[model samples]
Target: MSSSPIATVKRELLVRHLEAWAPAALHRARRVIYAHGYADADGGVSAEAAMRVLAEQSDLVRGRELIMVATGDDLGAIDPRLKTISAESGAGAGLAVHTISGGTDGRLPVGLKAVGAQRVPVLGFLDASGSEPPAPATVAALTAGKPSEMLLVLPPGSSASSVDAYRAGWPLFTQVELADSEEPGELLVYATTAGKSLEGFKEALWSVDEFAGVRYRDPGDPERHLIDISLTPHPGPLRRELLAHLAQAGEATVTELRTFALTETVYRAADATRVLHTLVDAGTVTRRPSHGRLGGDVVISA
Candidate 1:
């Protein structure tokens, strides 16, 4: 698709402003930390994803440090023990941690506390779902006696009016827009920082190639940085197609199946084989008993 002229102008403006703004923003805090309240259900965001975002931001705020604290339902759902391990690791890494229950007012659950001891002034809140940005009192408490930056990361279809309410009050903050398009999803990040070259910053945003698409907007009177990109599919469609094909076949030698099903639309034999094995291990499919060739009579059956 052709790029829109407005998008081009916006991109140019964004790079220019961030180059001038990021340095000043980082002047007070030597390190910036990011934390997510929830994962995108369509293609869940994890610490790995957060790290990618932070890495891009790090390039923008050259001298400053970056830390991450990821919270939400998926962590517990994917692996509770792993979640505990990650939290402990965060503390060891000197990162403040908090757990967020999705659909709440963007506040941490009752017993959770915002990370304070690290002297982190700016707290990036990812995936807020409620009507308000956050209570001023809550903001006061979170940033208490410290210079801080608060950015909101929200999904598409979020209430713009609610976001506007917060923007009206906090002009320095930026909003990063994320939309679930395709598999991996894309995020449009808009923010203003001091002493950073907007061009360099915009380039940094594009470094997240794992995402299918990305875009940036400049910081100005209506300072903006917008990123529009699609998410790379995980486990991809080809793998799924291979599994389905195998299920339909009832049972067949790997070589026989590969000859009939392998194509640009399907996974490579190696990947398909791996996926099949995974399904078998998960009990979603059964592997026939065979002690011969790696490409033996491997029957895929439910």
Candidate 2:
């Protein structure tokens, strides 16, 4: 069966993130564990994307590995395709693919353990399509004191409590509600400890081309504004968030505010800088080093 438009957008975003993350991850980690929960029969949409990343970064994979594990009730259809990819990618020696035919919630943990992922860096994409969300503990265990991250897809209109439960163990998280031509929409939660990972995720998020009939909503927005998916994203949301942050902080340096945007908000550091400049021109905020261009040391107060 073909995927719906929304599914296509989701998959595109997933591919973009994997492409952006894999290169940096391969540099320090011994293995890249990609665990897919509720995996599609054909190894999910991003498997090829992962292979492409591995192929492109072949030089970086001196002795490192990319282990792709797909878990579902019946993943028989994906095994051969994974083998083909492993062989064709020209990196077979560093590629390992496994298919576990069983419930994802149960099989994912076992699959991850079986592949010896406990000590390595793992990037897990857990989709709760036909099964309940994996226990929060399971997701947390993957990241506890380790250089691991998880991307979660929760059902439309999933309660805020459930979101909180999933975010408990991670020091940082970024969540966006993806709304399409439907009543309610899916929620994507990306949890990680490293600020660099969040930055890469935002880069991946904006890297995708705008798809028709799809919009992204930030749940934290009081107005619940929906943003269009575009290469040059709208900065209105970032403007508001920056002002609010300044209000809370009273005063901060340009460098500090940029860091806030990169880590705490969906906007990039450059986006934050531009918005702050506009605010300065409009007399909305005052800067101490007002004579020259706004450098990192310039202090700004609301």
Candidate 3:
């Protein structure tokens, strides 16, 4: 099936995350559950891509159990494709794939239980279409404890309250807007309580290959700036955010600032240092112990 470039990018984002998160999660949780909403309808690209990763990198998944629960109205097309992928990849005996033919509302929860999700870590990719997103209860179920994470693709103009409701219990939550040419596109929401999982996601977000005529928008940015998905993305948004954070705190250590960037903002912790050094060079902000390299111990004031 032919997929639009932007749609393909979204799938790649999920695959890239699984590539990074699955290995670490297997080591930490002993088992992994991947629940896909709208699996067959979207051609099962993400599930297929993710399963291929497990197949190709057998060493990382040797002992750990990986269960993939794919939910869709019908699996007539995707089921065969998935079977072929598993067969060709020669995925290990430990890997299990379940195709639930029903609405995600009822079947997703059932699939989760059938796989012992409560006892293991789960990575749910709720690829919601149009205005309707996965229910708040569905999202809450995924955030039951640490190491369980959820990713949602919400339509444009989705309510802030809907997102807030989805983010309710998670200690860490972040979203990136997929731009559609000139206008803002769908929103990709990620919620989790695990710091390591969140860190892995952030790495995946910036590392995915750049798509033409598309850029990711920092939803937190007031101007709704569209930025490229690159290692050294423009730090304009971080610059403003740091100034506001410094204004409120009066002064903060480099470590504190870096943590703020990591936890509270879309920018990575490494971006914090680069923006700070630029600010200091411009004389917009001052750093104590300015005579030496910008270490974590150095303090910054606006």
> For model 1, what is the alpha-carbon lDDT of residue 120?
53
What tens digits encode model 2's per-residue C-alpha lDDT throughout 20-63? 77776787687877777777633455555554555666666658
Candidate 3 per-residue lDDT, tens place, 1-302, comes to: 42876777888888888777677777877678888887765667776776676656556556777778888778777887776666675556667678888767778887788778885778888878543677788777776434688888888877678778887778888888888665768888887878777777888888888777778877777777778889898898888889989999999999999888887777788999999999999999998987799999999998
Candidate achieving higher TM-score, 1 or 3: 3
TM-score of 3: 0.90
Q: Which 10 consecutive residues of model 2 have the lowest summed lDDT? A: 41-50
Backbone clashes for every candidate come to: 30, 0, 0
- The per-residue C-alpha lDDT of model 3 at residue 176 equals 80
Query: In lDDT terms, how accurate is model 2?
Result: 0.76
Regions of candidate 3 where Cα sits further than 4 Å from its true position: 57-63
TM-score (C-alpha) between model 1 and the true structure: 0.39
Q: State every prediction's TM-score relative to the real structure.
A: 0.39, 0.86, 0.90
Please give the lDDT score at residue 20 for candidate 2. Answer: 70
- Candidate 1 residue-wise lDDT, 1-302, digit = tens: 11333223323333333333334445657755444444433233343334433333443444444444454544445334334544544333333234454533344423224443245544444334322344434433334313333434443444446445444323233333333332222223332232122223334433333333333321111322233422222334434555656667666666555433332221234445666666666777666663443454666564
